[model samples]
Target: MTTTPGDKFSYKIELHIHLDGAIRSETILDISKTKGRPIISVDDDGQETVITDQESLDKEIVITTPCSLKLFLHAFNVFMPIIAGDRDAVFRIAYEFCEDCAKSGIRYVEARYNPHLLANTLDKPAYARERGDFSPRDVVITVCDALDKGSRDFNITVNSILCCMTHQPDWSAEIVSLCKEFKDRGVVAIDSAGQDFEPGKDPLLCGHKKAFKEAYDNGIHRTVHAGENGPSEGVREALDHMYAERIGHGYHVTDDPELYSRCKEDGVHFEICPLSSIITGACPEDIMKHPLIRFADEGVNFSLNTDDPIILNNALADDYVLANKMGLSDEQIINSIFNAARASFATEEQKKKMLQDLVNVYGEH
Candidate 1:
């Protein structure tokens, strides 16, 4: 196919990837064995008996959804214990994550994770001594340092965002403070992640209002996990309550034309993760039927991403390819790429430079 001037392929950016869920499967297994943790079984018979439903599972093992969220969360349980007490483990994970993104041809990527979850893994003795030392602040710092080092080492640029689990809104104050503390260290935004189906466990509960206010007040960028497992209300809450500049998995907005129009008008970028959505049962069985295309047709500002690459077994290119196969035209693909670049938390100057780079690579005027 003779590509048009505007069809020339160029820059790609993934703004909604999850850090912990992006860890390599083999790497998780290695960490699990090293920590003497029993591996969750997924045998040939498919009789793997991990927690399929959060309601049915023991409280100790937090399983959220049977389809997608359950699997994603279970995957985390396998690795969290292994990497918790060790600083080097956290560093290695961040390093490897960047390496994976670079290998996948992601020039600039923003990976988000809940630092509190990782902080809960501090060395038992160290944590015990302090009694009140349950903090992932150091892990956040070390991981950022490792990411920066890896970025320099691998010739790829990666930024980290500390995600707040919305189930715990009180932690927002601390997370926002951490974002400010590490603003210069590559911690750019705050995110709320986890199963979105729980009643009253909304982004607002996670200090979305306060966090966004703080981020704006501090001149930091803001993003939120919205519209994944809930209705249009969740999407509206993310915008009205949190003032999120970018939305993670805002797929449900498709159900509400008004909100979709609002998103389009306000230029709130939706970080759509195809594989994750499919695997999590958030999307229909067919990729072509995904509402993202409809939203794209409506000119909603959005971009493709791999929310949990490891769990979904996907990458940035995979998403692009999927979109293409699902009938996205070359122009739409290029536009989505530009949308991502523009929606990125990078500064205006950076966005301009990236857009120019895209035009140069794709020959798009």
Candidate 2:
């Protein structure tokens, strides 16, 4: 078991956590039971297992070993349908996510998700679900409402980012619109997430490029999932074409010396998820050789994050633990926390307060 970083630092800031991937297993089980939906788990041998209890369900959804990105994402297929398309489930998850973050000593967090994935009204639902009246617009409204209340009730500053699935470039326009529509209502940014780019393929799809350009023109904050499973060029593409202010799991940026130098010189904020990197096979299994070590050595502007806590079966503290084990000093960890606060999409006033709070606890870095 990993030690909880909260024991040492009570105030933490997280920049890259997924709202959908951080749902509680207990909540998933409860939703499945209430909906009378049978939980199915498929094995590597092509065998299907029925998950009836929390134990079985956890075993099915939580990944303990390193796996391909394809296998890691399969965990979502097991339970997303149980919660998606259900208004109460969506609201409850957002609220409970705040509570969980508070429990983990996270003072401020920016959660991200694809609004359409939770909306059943899509002509082709993200998952296999019947059509309904709950539009993607409705999803953003519900999420913003729940996050606002949760932020107040839990005493944590929580904002959300609407994601454009990489494969669904057509959805990008609507996603950017939702980001604008809900900018004051808790939505802070737009992110491009979904499948990784195949080798030698252009990382920035044309539609995504146009939408991100629009987001840029409209003053919407932008982040993109690049260079995690894709090559270093993907990171360059995100910076050049998408106006990405921050990068998600941009480990491979180190692969290109010129690009890496540019990112370092430009102070691009990299949201690095240490455990997620290993589990998703974005980095090698060897912890010591992790790009994070190089990032620390090079003084890269980056922050540690829990990319998918449910699938990784970890909390924010767990990521801190892994970073510590990987040779990050206490000072380095604290620096990352401060980096997150500075790079956050929060308003300047809020960011100032958060930084002051950190200084009060950490005593001038």
Candidate 3:
């Protein structure tokens, strides 16, 4: 049976979703119109297509089939130019994420994004065309303010994680600082985003490494995107070098028997995005042979997630549907929910409350 929102479950926990990747198409269109920014994107053939409505915008952002990670990332280039550097757009997206989570019965979520990607402070901004007064620090502040308000207004707990892109290790120190500064305002952790190192290639122990160490020293939680498109060695590097408390899309960890055993023994949480794994070519096409099934069968600590709903054209429910299709029993599915709650970076008191709420919904784990 498919676990749709508000169907089988009354409450849920999601740990791996990108805030920028989940923006509503209608919101993007509305913001573009309001700012007088043209909604245009270049197609595979190099022809520019003018997006005039929600349908066209969705066509640009949503991935309908399996694709390489590189192609999947290109979806961001389609609309981020309109959303990034805009204060209202940034706030609205963060706030609306809460509303969407509530609708999906997600009671607690740790939404992550790169503040630098959203800011227009640098001479060469990540997405924005022109430099502006808004800095990465301002992006964190805006997201915190919006998430705080959204959590209160929507009656769901929401927290943010600052991401450090692999290409821009220079931003890692500032990201960790922002995490510390906004700890009271709902920023919970530091994350490594963007591309991962290829197999046999050593993870760059540069500024990113230093920042992660600082976060570890200061009590900040850490997660890394490893072994999704990269090899299992990347997962080893993340754990050994970056001190990752959680592994994001760590499917390829299974490729290393020793590493996989270590992770399972250590209870390292894997944020498994089922639909995303398929569509992003991070795993095999057959659901029956998916790593999530192996994780479930082996009793690995893992949580299902909709990694990028807007891009994947899915919801939390869609992820559950895929898990069900993979023949995961309801017991396993519910266990994944509990796994997410236990692995979350929330405070001990907060985790206690969240675990109690999960038991209330799912009935004694």
lDDT of 1: 0.71
Q: Report the lDDT of model 1 for residue 358.
A: 81
Query: What TM-score, over all chains together, does every model reach?
Result: 0.84, 0.96, 0.97
Candidate 3 global lDDT: 0.89
Candidate 1 segments whose C-alpha is farther than 4 A from its true place: 1-10, 34-68, 121-134, 197-206
Question: lDDT by residue for model 2 over 1-365, one digit each (tens)?
Answer: 12364467788899999999999988888878888877787677989877889888888888988998988888998888887888888999999998899988999999999989998998888863678888899889889889999999999999999999888888999999999888898799999998775434645488888999999999999999999998999898889888999999999999999999999999999999999999999998999989999999899999999989888888878888888889999899999999999999999989999999999999786
Model 3: per-residue Cα lDDT over 1-365, one tens digit each = 12265457667899999999888878889988989988889978999988989888887788878999889989998889998898888999999999999888899999999999999998899998789998999999899889999999999999888999888878888999999998888889999988776534545547788999999999999999999988999899899988999999999999999999999999999999999889989988888889899999999999999988889778887788779889998889999999999999988888999999888778887
Q: What is the lDDT of residue 187 in candidate 3?
A: 87
lDDT tens digits, residues 1-365, model 1?
01123323446777888887777666655665565554444434766644333232233232223376655566565345556656667788899988887767677888898777766534442212222343678778878888998899888778878887766676678888999998888888887777673335533474656777887788878787777867767778777767678888878887888888778888888888776777677788687898888877888888888777655556677777767877887788778878888878776666788788888877673
Please, what's the RMSD in Å of model 1?
6.5
Model 1, position 24: C-alpha lDDT score: 67
Clash counts for all predictions: 3, 0, 0
Clash pairs detected, candidate 3: none
Per the 3 Å backbone cut-off, how many clashing residue pairs does candidate 3 have?
0
